[model samples]
Target: MLDPKLMDEPARIAALDRYDVLDTPREPGFDRITNLVRSILGVPISAISLLDRDRQWFKSLNGLDASETPRDIAFCDYTIRQRAPMIVTDAHADARFCDNPYVIGDPNIRSYAGIPLETPDGYNIGSLCAIDIVPRQFDPGQIAILQNLAALVVEQLELRRIAERDHLTGALTRRAFLGEMNRAIALFERHQRPASLLLFDIDHFKQINDNHGHPAGDQVIRGIARLCTGLQRPSDSLGRLGGEEFGILLPETGQEDAARAAQRFCETIAATEIPGTPPLRVTVSFGVAELRSDWPTCESWLAVADMALYEAKRSGRNRVAIARHDASHAT
Candidate 1:
């Protein structure tokens, strides 16, 4: 039996949650590494394994035939539990693995070498492992090289996490938002199809700071953030540029669809009534901008949307404003 201290199932689950990499498709970089392992080690099976609650999932595999297998039958499970490299020269002879299904059954592992995949926090999530049907040995130098390769996998995962999140709203940040927006725009640009941007401002935000205090203001901000999260499409991104201002990147949507979405969001806020001691009410104004070929840069496209937003605030508070291009001018 595995020691409780060596493999805390609950702790491992929590570490996997932080990376948010479960069930994700095989990434090219990880696939390349596994391919290299198979070539160098001359193994019929090489895998980048991620330890799940009850299973070890192969994110990338060179010669493995299954997507996943029970963790109890996984050599990587034991490898993840170890601080140093785990080497089993002959699984049928080792007490820990002799009865294991992999050793006795299909794949019939005769030799295995596993290097634990670790997070920056030192939690071992799984292993980069190679398996062979015939017994073989790895030199000490070879073990060190495999460990370094696993470190590179961790580095890539960290970089991806940093790219997609907004620091303030905990939503998709601006860079990721715009990148998706550009992809959508390119698909619709040929037809001159358009989308809309909803620019929302927390009405009299400074007054909230002045009257109730900044702490209260912060609460309101968080309240608004909660309302907006998951409010838009999985493709659409909601973000906070700065201060009380926020924007949504809508894709493949016209002005009418944007207006309807904005209206529904406004009504949702009214019914919820953001948190406050005196039961304070909050409202947001929206600005809709249609995509145009004349606006070559994302900055210029956003400028038109911001202009429309300024108009919404100018006309009155808490209303949606539609963008109208000047026919006389190019855009």
Candidate 2:
């Protein structure tokens, strides 16, 4: 029986969402493990199941089985709800199994054992289970090996999660951001659809550390990051390029749009009230530039924006400056 209280639907759904790995095609590494289990144990079926909202989705499976089954009839559902292995020696003999559709009808699972697949933090996401038409028993060694295999499944899932994330701001961290930027630039160059980059930096961030304290400065940096993130559009990318500097990649935006975004970033920082500190207002300067066809690469296009940023700092701090590549660099 499933524990109603412990099997939190919302938390489980949230965990599944974080993986960003639903409905993906099967990978060979996962398939190999399921095949090995079936071959070694001489079972009719073996699977690496992921418990989804209303179904048990098989990432990997061996033998005749469907890719998905209803959650109500899913053995993996009960498997994940428990911390330890769920073993049913004879489905017909057990009270819980006798009433199960899987036991009485199709598949007729007579012998079953499943080990929970858990994340590093101990959230049991699903299970690695083996099924046989005939009743059977597993030795201690087999159970241990199955548990170890489930751990490997989790390791693979974690690797995929880290690959898609940006290490700095906990946002989409792919070099692919530039790939999208390039496409946007191409459209702007062709149809004059308008695009811009708001390159900016923390004003006197170094002095903040020297005066207030490094910890306070770190808080300020984090505060700025939050502000920038809050000001972003779904289509916009806000990333920390390096220390004390950040880049906002905007699409379909002109000088006015870029200037507005820059102003919002600066104002957000100024209005924020830092804890345990006097009313200290922070400011940021901006360099806005439009995309150009002559700039064949992302680097060259960004160079124009960077130059505008340099001018903003040189003219005076806490100001926005626009750079047109057609014009000479801001002196």
Candidate 3:
């Protein structure tokens, strides 16, 4: 079995998530580095691999047709464990890899080298790797070049993260979230495909901090972030929108479906315990709004949702409210 300890570390996994690079579209910066690794090492295949819980996903691939593979048979998994350059001189002669399915069949990797990609906070997220079908020795000088390329990958990841992520909850920031919402809105305009917005506010959140402490309050915030993230679809996005509030952008989702999702969140939030608190459970009020052909602008989309959220807050506390055409005009 693969090293269970390295694969299960939450801090390292979370560090990988903070980069927000997994399953994201290819970019030239990462592509260029993979290209450089291929050239520098004279390998047939190269990739920028990001490790997730069950799979090693490639953010950039050159000379490889596949996008991902299971973690158990992944050479990159071993590379991530040591956070160093891991070179398998000859997979056919090595006990650890000789019978591996990948080597025995397609891609037929015989020699492999992976340089670990590190976050600034010191977690090794994944690797920049070079693979060849023929066994060979790795020159020390070539390995140094591969390490430098790995550094460039890290630099790009950190830059993308700072610009796109919220520092507190590990969700997208308000600006970034709305930026995506705007694109969904444009898609709605051109294609008439429906998208829904869910805005939720923690019920009685001030008491979390007042009764416990600021540290406890922060734990609650992070917990809510995790809960909402677990409830979202692959294409859906969850984001922290200022204090005590979060936004979910659900493209190709309708109002009723969004409400069902919000209800799930309400139930989950109430049942969840804050990591640092003995009895602190959170309840949230939701404002769900779907795009309307009659709506004038993107600003109106949020306005409608915010008004629904206000109604949810006013009606009781921990319930969901939907925005309708008539409701949009209501004070």
lDDT of 2 by residue, 1-331 (tens): 8655346768877777677565555778899889888887778899999988898888898886588889888888888887889888888898877888888888888988899887765577789988999888887888887888888888888986686555545644434345456656666756776677778888888888898887777677677777677878977876566667777888778778788878777677767875536335688888887666655567876777788788889998788888765633322
Q: Arrange candidates by TM-score, descending.
A: 3, 1, 2
Candidate 1 segments exceeding 4 Å error: 1-7, 173-226, 229-331
Which pairs clash in model 3? none
Cα deviation of 125, candidate 2, in Å: 1.0
TM-score, candidate number 2: 0.53
All candidates: CA RMSD (Å): 9.2, 9.3, 9.0
Candidate 3 residues lying further than 4 Å off, grouped into runs, are 1-8, 166-247, 250-254, 257-331
Q: Which has the better TM-score: candidate 1, or candidate 2?
A: 1
Q: What is the lDDT of residue 321 in candidate 3?
A: 94
Best TM-score among the predictions, by candidate number: 3
Candidate 2: which pairs clash?
Answer: none
